[model samples]
Target: MIYFVYQILPHNCRSVRSILCSSLFLQKKGKKGAKAVEEEPVQVDAKDRIDFDSAKQKLQAVVDRFAKYANDAKLGKTSPKVFDNLMVQTDHGDQPYTSLAQTSIKGRNFIMTVYDPANIQRIINSVLGSGLNLNPVVDPSNKLTLKMPLPPITTELKNESVKELKNVYEKLRNGASLGKNHTLSSIRADARHKLTKNKKLDNLETEVWNEYEKLHKIYVSKLSEMIKAAETAIMK
Candidate 1:
């Protein structure tokens, strides 16, 4: 989900000013020989759940890294490549984006996706300007936050989309029964191609995606309710 439009800035010389400055000292010694120095990572607690305080600290560390001017000379304007160096991940895998900082030039949109799907949600939740980080607007994954508020779709529209997807799915079933080689990708691709060719397809694509999202949410909500009902029955 897209969040936070930021004004592009210039003059980023702050990279030189490294953090934890208090640890560094002026050790001017005789015959100063320089060798590589490996810094230690800031440690966190072994708690299972993430504490908000700890989350805030981690967020600050992220901000500090990207807090440089949007147009730093070292990091060319509109280049999200620099964040690749930073190893950001979630329990599942590396995050889709570390920090998605976007800037538009004139009219063309220059978007920077951090692709750190692992930590993507935490960062986006933090960036959304919300005081509290609720689970997620749409939890694509533990790391990825599909943060946009779900578009309000009429019941008719939802029904129609379900019908359409089912119809397409039926075609896939029919094709398979005929011994015509058909895979999920093949079916989806065929359906996608047809949808893409439609005159009002852009609108249709959004509605269709929304319908899928709604169905998924419904499944999860209903599944949980069913589980609770079953548990109660068992207890009785």
Candidate 2:
């Protein structure tokens, strides 16, 4: 004897008949040729039964909450250590100005400095002329300061390199898990040795080094421009 099973599932509150099996054999030959009865569970498509509208609404709510948190907590701001510090040396018997002010503008923080207060506007103009974003502020308790944004290309390249290195390390760790004899240090050493021969890793390292050089050049050029502008403004 054979039996057919059909399951009716609700799709958006509408009844839809879902056939699990066209025919299910109920009788089978036993060890001694006796008849045996067998039963099988019916399968249903879960996706067909799901309420898409409700799911989409719930998912949207979660996305909205995450967006709110990201904005409210300033999660998109880069860490301060990522920025290269600009140091200015002074003549003998004068204290070197390390930073004019450490302040936040538009959710990003900067260590700002100006050589002379009289040329502050010139410095600001020079920075703007160099196509860099800046927010100049004067505090009664502190010197005139200019907020500078980090170099986007350099930061992005560094972040990409870090992410790639992390992925490589994860692969190394996963490889180590296959053998109890392998330690983290040993794996790291092996990975370093392998990286020397790895074309991809070598290319990434070279790119990162090149980006650092570019960043240095940019920083020096901007600093020089600012200094020149300040001196010019002072003369006027």
- Cα-lDDT of candidate 2: 0.41
What overall lDDT goes with each candidate model? 0.37, 0.41
**How high is the lDDT of residue 136 in model 2?**
44
* Residue lDDT tens for model 1, 1-236: 22344454557722232233222243432224344455789553223222334433433332232223212312231233423333334565544334343222222222333344445555454434332222224434422334332223345433443344334334432333223444223333444443455545445466664553353344334434433443333223
CA lDDT, candidate 2, residue 13: 69
Off by over 4 Å in 1: 1-146, 176-236
Tell me each candidate's RMSD, in Å, in order. 34.8, 24.1
TM-score of each: 0.17, 0.22
Please give the distance, in angstroms, between residue 131's alpha carbon in candidate 2 and its true position after superposition. Answer: 12
Using lDDT, give the best candidate's number. 2
